[model samples]
Every structure is written in C-alpha cells, then in structure tokens.
Target chain A: MTYCVAMRVDEGLVFLSDTRTNAGVDHVSAARKMAVFEQPGDRVLVLLAAGNLALTQAVMQLLSEPAPEDKPTLYNVATMAEAARLVGDAVREVHRRDAATLAEFSVDFNCSFILGGQIRGANTRLFMIYSAGNFVESSQVSPYFQIGESKYGKPIIDRVVTPSTPLDEVAKCALVSMDSTLRSNLSVGLPLDLLVYEKDALQVTRFSTIDNDNHYFQMIHRTWGERLRQIFGEIPNPTWADPANVPLRARETVSNVPRVTGSELRAEPDTSAPPFQTLMQPESGQSQH
Target chain B: MTYCVAMRVDEGLVFLSDTRTNAGVDHVSAARKMAVFEQPGDRVLVLLAAGNLALTQAVMQLLSEPAPEDKPTLYNVATMAEAARLVGDAVREVHRRDAATLAEFSVDFNCSFILGGQIRGANTRLFMIYSAGNFVESSQVSPYFQIGESKYGKPIIDRVVTPSTPLDEVAKCALVSMDSTLRSNLSVGLPLDLLVYEKDALQVTRFSTIDNDNHYFQMIHRTWGERLRQIFGEIPNPTWADPANVPLRARETVSNVPRVTGSELRAEPDTSAPPFQTLMQPESGQSQH
Candidate 1:
C-alpha cells in the first residue's frame, strides 16, 4: 500500500516515501509519510513509515509526545541505535494498546518504519524496524532498507547500490526505484517526500515534496522506460538456427523437451504415472506397445 | 518457488519456466515444470505450473493418464479453449481428492498454470488458471501471464512486450524477466525450460533446456546487467542547484517537507495530529506559542 526506501551510503543517508494510502481501491487518499526530527548542530533524524495508516499514525503520535523527564525520547536519544529503540518501543506501545481492539474487527496490527540519521557523536546509520518492535541496521553488505511494496523496484537497487555509492547517485537510485514501483503498482502514488542528508550535517539541508508536475521526476518516469526499451532492442535476439554458436544452446546430457502423449510427439511419457486414470486415451492398438 | 511466464504475440507464443522447487530453504531441488501436448499438424498445447509441487504434479499426472472412452482429452480437444478447460478440470479433480486432507495439515491448495498454444482451426490462445479451476485468457492489452514470485520481473515485461512484439524479442523479454527474478529471489533458480511455438506449426519447434553452462543465457545474464548499469550511468544525475533546469523539481503549492516538533526545526508540525500525544515535544517556551 506504500513504498518507502532509505539508503546508507558512504556519503550520507537518503530517505523517500510515497503519499498514497487506501482502505480499498475506492478509498484512496494521500498522506505524507516522511517525518524529520532536528536539533540543528546536535543531531538530525528522519523517519519513514508504511502500513496501516491508523497504526502508523498512532506510533508517530507516541513518538511526538513530550517525554517524561526521566525517559528517553527521539529528541534526547544519545545514539542512532537508541533512536531506533525509541521507535520500536513506541510501536510496541501502540500494539499493546490497539492490537486487541483492532483484532476484534479482523484488522491485523501492521506497520514498519525506516529510521536513519546522525547523532552528533556517531556515524550516519540506517535501521528498519518491524511491526513486532524489533529492528536491523544497515551493513556494508546490505546498504539499504525498503518497506511496503518493495519487490517491483528491487532488482535495480540490488544491482546498482553499494556502500560506496555517492549520496547524489543514491538519491537518484531511490527515485528511479520509486518510479519503477509507481508504474507497476497503482497503490503507490505521487507527491513524494525525499530527503537527502549529508553525513555529519546535523541538520536537514535538501528536502523536496515532489508532485506530478515535478520536472525531475517527470524526466525519470519518461526516460527510464524509454531507455529500457531501447536497450532491450539493442541486445541481439536468440538465434535458433545454430545452437552451437549461441549462448543459450540446448545441453547434450539433459533430457529433451517434455511432450505429452499423442501422435507425432517424440519425448517419452513420464514413467511415474498417476494413481488415477487421466483424460488422455491412447489410440486403439497403441496401448499394447 | 518457481517463475513461469507465457506470452501471446502476433508471431507466435513463448513460454519460459524455472526448474527450482523447495519444501523449504534446506530442501531445494529441481523439477521440470513445462509439459507439452502436441498432435503435429493438428494442435499443440503447453502447460507451465507453479505452487505446491505435489498438487501441481498430481494435476499433471491426472492430465497425462489414459482418458476414458466418453471424455475429451488433450489429444481430442478441438480448440485451445477446450485445452485450457481440460487442464482446469484436472485441477478441480485434484482439489476434490486432496484439498481437505491438505487442509488438516494447514497446507494451502495453492497452484496456478499458464496454458498456451494453437489448434488447426483457431488463433493462438493463452490462459492463466487459478487454484479454484477458473481461468482468464490473455488479451492484447495484457498479453502475458506469470505465476509464482512474479513481481520482481514484471516491470520489464510491462514496458517491452505487446501483441505486435516479434517471437524472438518476446523470448528475449521472457529471459530478461526470468533473469531479474533469479537475481532478486533465491527460491527461483536456473536450468530453465523454454519453449517457442510458431503460429500454425501445431507442434513444438524451438525448445531448450538451458543450464548454467548455456552460453546464450550466460551472455544474457551478464550483458543485461552491464548494459543496465551503463544506461543508468548515462542518465544524468539530478542537479540540486536549479530546480528550473532539472526534471525532479519540488512543486511550490504543496506543503513543505514534514518536520517533527523540536528546537530549531523550521517546518510546521502536522496540524491534523492523531487524537493521541506524539513523542515529539516542542522545547520549553516553544510549545506555548
């Protein structure tokens, strides 16, 4: 129902989220899902959420409330890990209060969050928190986290992103990923929230609320598809005439293509027959063979 | 898990399927999923399946057994529609025999099929049959069907394949789609079965059991990813300096990027807050204003 992705590259952190939410096909509406917490020179934190609107809003509400003097809150958390724990605690708190009532109506308590930023003393870090109030941080081998409708746009990110990727390039990749998702899935729509944080900046510098009219996103939507088609054409089609010369030749030892029982079919029928009779009837005398 | 896709184009039909099947990550094995029924100069039918391995194999077994004197079989079906109906009927029969028992074990009666080919008097047809034994035929607007782990590879097919696409190109698109799927999902693996049928041939003409050593598929596996990264690089990165010159500019009318309440934070807190308190607290004097 949503697409939110965040990357932790060597240069910085990038966060992006879509605005669309729906109860069903007919009840579609837009809601911004990116939230920023800043303390200027001290720390900067960004939270992106996906899942049930009510549950996410509830978690966000708990996170936004003033903390009791002795407790930790997003504003006073000393480290990125602590910030994530605070988010997880809020999620669990919501689950504690709302899960039972929501379960009565058959609504599963579901929500996920991407929390990424720098606290003055630490390095930029990114974490994905689950519906169950647990989380995992990004690592060198896995430099990103995506929540919601993630598969359609995943291949490209899996191919292009690494910890070494530049901040601007990572930002571009995130938008491109979002574009692919928006095209393939109707549930994720525009008016996006994109935030690019430079490592150690300790403040939000580059942020945008992109709508249908955004020129840069418009170019990506058009150019990515067109260029993809262009490259697809540029690749040579498989040549069946000479299997020996082609890369996708049929192998020698493997069995031939499977063909069902019928006149003029070459491949043998599967020896492991079913326990019951099939709809296929052999020609009069052929069964004897 | 498996990835099976079939396309219906003006030139002919293309069907591609992966061989990997798994009871769980620890019990991975390979089993061919494409089965063909051909009557040479009369008709040709191909079935590609995905879902519970036992259920699909059971349905396939029922289709392969000897038909009784009175019923229609793959050999006797007059049209492609009849062929799809026969397959659907086999699926329903399997459900009747096994669904309840499987339910006791909590295993779903989940399986789906892509059936396509041509008969002497009719045009090429493709249908996607669901677990319930109901099916829907492919149309010009949506000319392909994919079952099991399909989302990862869908965007490319959505952009490139259409009814007017040529046979070889369709085959290439299918492979590229499969390649994307293989990259993102560990459950779908190689040693793929590919079958290409030309209109009016009424028999299997081009088929390949492509393994990891298959050169053409190797070329596809390498070149596609390389060229994709190349093209991704060719697209200029978004320039943040001037929104007017770029394609991803932020719109002026929409609200500014969201910022949670905190000292030195510029953007306003969401005015329509949830009915509960948020973890965000405006600093001492800041909240009173």
Candidate 2:
C-alpha cells in the first residue's frame, strides 16, 4: 500500500509519495516511490507511484529509458498532456509484459501513477495514470489527483485545493494529507518524497525526502492530531434521553426509550390493534408509554 | 457503497451509518443502512450494513424474524460475542442460499456488517462481521470497526479512538469520520442513523436519524470543513530550492534522485547531454555540491 498525491495549482504543481513497500506485513521494506526527471531548463517531470512495487518499478524503468525516435517520451513531449500519455504508454507496456504471468498466481495487474510537471513551453499539469495505461489530467475545477491508499487522505484535498491556491499552501496541504495517510495505513510509511514545482521553472525547486526525524513533518503529524481532538471536543455531544433538548427537531421526534417489551406488544394486543405498530419505527422515535 | 462505523469505548458503543445506495453512477437512491433491534432492559443491537444492498436487506429480513431455539439470535444471546457470531451465522445462512445463484449471473455475494451493543449482564462490545460469515470482536487495543467504503474516513478515527476515550468524544469522532467519508464518496450520502449506547444501560439512549437539514449536523459539517482549512493554513509550506534556509533537511541519505538518473543509463541515454548534467562525482557523505 502506498499513498501518492499531486496537485496542479495556478502557480505550480506539488507531488508527494510515501516510501514503504511490503510483499506482506512481515516483509515490509523501504522503497522510494517518487522519481524526478529534470533536464534542467527544459523540463522537470515528477512521477509518484503506487500498487505492486514490481509493476511500478517496471513502469518507471520503462519510462526512464529514452524512447526510440518514432515513439513519444516524456523527455521530448511537447506538452504536459503528451508527457502523461507517454506515462500511460509505459504503464501499458509493463502490463503487457507481466500481467499474464502474474495472473497465474492470482495477482491483479494493480499499479497506478501520478505524473505531473511542465515542458519548456507548456503549462504545469497533473494527471493520474491507471493500470490500463489510460489517464486523466487535473483541471481548475478538480486541481489534484491521488493514487494508492487515497481515500484516507482525500477529504482534506477535496476541501482545500483549487487552481488558484498558492503553490506553497498546496504543498502544506499535501504534507498534511500524507500525514493522515501515514497514520492510518501501515503500508504507507515514513521517508516521504516531496517535490514542489513552480510553474515554468523547468527545474526542481523544493524537494524534500522526509524520514521520521524531519521536523516540519513531525510538527504536522502532532499538531493535526491535537488540534483535531481539540475541535472534536468543542463539538456538542448527543443529548441521549432528553427529547425537548435535542439539537435537531427531526431527531427530537424520536425518543431514546425502548418501545418494545420482550417482543410482546406494549400496546393493545388484540388483532384489531392499529397497524401502525408494525411500521418501521426507530427505537429513537418511540417511548414506552 | 456505504460507510458505517461502530466503536466500543469504555462508556459504551457508538454506531453511525450513512444512507445512500447506488447500483451505478446513474442509478442512485437513498435507503437507510442501519437497523436496530432493541428489547429494552435486556438487549440493544444495532446493525450497520454495507455492500450489496439487496443482500443486506435479505439478511436483515431473515434476522428480524423470530429466532429458532437452537440458533443464537442477538435478541437472546448470552454475550455480545455470541451475538456477533449469530450475525455472522446469519450472513452465512444468506450466503448459502444466495451466493451460487448470484455467482451464476456474475454478481458477487458482497456484503458485510458492523454489529455492536450490549446485552444485560454483559459488557459493551463491538464486532465486524465479514461476508464469509466470520467475525472479529474489538479489543481495548483496537476498539472499533468500520464497514463499507471505510478507508476515506479512517485516519481521524485511527488517531483519536481508544477504549479510554469518553463516550461523547468518541461519538463526536465517529460523526467527524462519517463527515470525511461523506465528503469523499458520493455512494455514502445523507440521512445518517446514529446510535450511542451507555454501558450497562441495557437500553437505547443517544440516537438520531440525521439528514442534511439537521441543524446540529449542519453545524458540524460547516465547522469541521472550516476548521480543517484553518489548521491546514496554519501548517508551514515547504521551503524549496534553498535547503540551507529551511529548518529541516530536504535530502535523504539514500536519496532517490540518483536512482532516477541511474536507471536512465541502464537504458539508451542522451546522444546529446541535454542542458542539465547529472553531477558525475560527489564527495563522500555529500548529496549536493
């Protein structure tokens, strides 16, 4: 399991990836999942990967090699979109080679990547490339892409990112997002690779490889937890037995008191009894009269 | 898809479930995913279901009927553990009857549940019952379980929950967790059912069917998102380019930057060395010149 997130904001792009890999829980190992390809002054491409480590590694290997003259490669791609397609093609190449053999052992061809950056003349762009060698580029409306163990870290991104967001701020949010992922998932461990690219820079600007001892990340991990609890403490707890005091009217309509007495009707037991008793009445809405 | 979380804290149990069901992206409808069977003064069992809605509905129908004498039904179970097993058994019963037929049509017998509550004379407890009809109970060390579309909402709970957490606080955490899940997943929607039980009460107490219009929930929704962004803003953004100015080190000892270029040499490289040059030699212990 890994968690990789990249954002395409108006100012630039931010990419972050966790470094833990595991064949199983017992075989956990550290493996860098982010690769930076910089032909300084021309292009700076960051690739964040997740899923089967072997497959991701294979795809990375395929992409690192300069493609034959007739084939498009990230190094020579005219635009960020074309660079993303080159990544997708690399993923497909790896899949075509290994998917069948791995399937014999019940391994799904599971792997994905986030490819984002700028070519000399193009705008910074972000994309999420899939196992099938297909991809989607991020846009202003949705200025980010996440791959691998994404959900635990997504809500924050969904709430915070916009194309107009400051590049530095998005980098902070990406780290916080990664912190959340690291806490919840064991497979996504420490030693994170964080790259912050300023639009049109054509060179890596901010690149941090954070391990457990990194101060800023440590601050993020601790502060986020303490502040979350503080905020959680401020929220009101449910009013259990009181009806009139309930916070919401619809909730007050339900009483916490139990309506049934040992499966024996609490009301008139005659067959002529009101048909209302059998209706889907929540215990919260009923009180023993 | 669904998102349901149940926690067994020292004070008691908390169960929360969202109410959205989607057969596909285009076919979405709302249906409650929580079912409560409260035999007040004796037992209170809350069932939160996720996965195939039809299958869960079937299991619910089967469980709601009077239990056979030999079968340990939640209504008559001696302990919370036994009740969890009964739920598991019921899942198996449904699977035995429905799985093969569903498999014939390329459907899966995919459904799972979180069953938690207390029975008279027993301690409060929680259990996660899987589709295989096997289940695991929560312990003091790992005192909660989540089912269906769970990952997105997991980080906060992972960081905040413990057996020692107060009931009200845990309840707040569960709601916050649900909020995260709701924001990230369309499959998990509104009109949530929340139940919080007090230990040894042997009766339902704190319960609410919260919808989008509920005031308290509206407050939580608004406040949580705002607070998250505020905290996100507070965290410092990465310092790029000039590592010397940053408080934290930005490079790792076994850095991946070298690997990026190394892999390139393993493949056909540049006939023209492009503009950026990989530094050919580095003094021992130094990553940058």
Best by TM-score: 1
Best by lDDT: 1
Considering the two chains of model 2, state its CAPRI-style docking category: acceptable
Candidate 1 residue-wise lDDT, B1-289, digit = tens: 9999999999999999999999899999999999988766777789999999999999999888776657788777777788889899999999999999999999999999999998898999999999999999999999999999999999999999999999989999999999999999999998888888888877666777777776678888999999889888887666543222223222343536487865322233323321111111112111210
Q: Write the residue-wise lDDT of candidate 1 on A62-139 in tens digits.
A: 888766667787888889999999999999999999999999999999999999999998999999999999999999
Chain A TM-score, cand. 2: 0.84
Candidate 1 interface RMSD value: 11.7
lDDT of each: 0.83, 0.75
Model 2 alpha-carbon miss at residue B182, Å: 0.9
List candidate 2 stretches off by more than 4 Å. A66-71, A244-289, B67-72, B240-252, B255-259, B262-289
Q: True contacts preserved, each candidate?
A: 0.44, 0.31
- Estimate the lDDT of model 2: 0.75
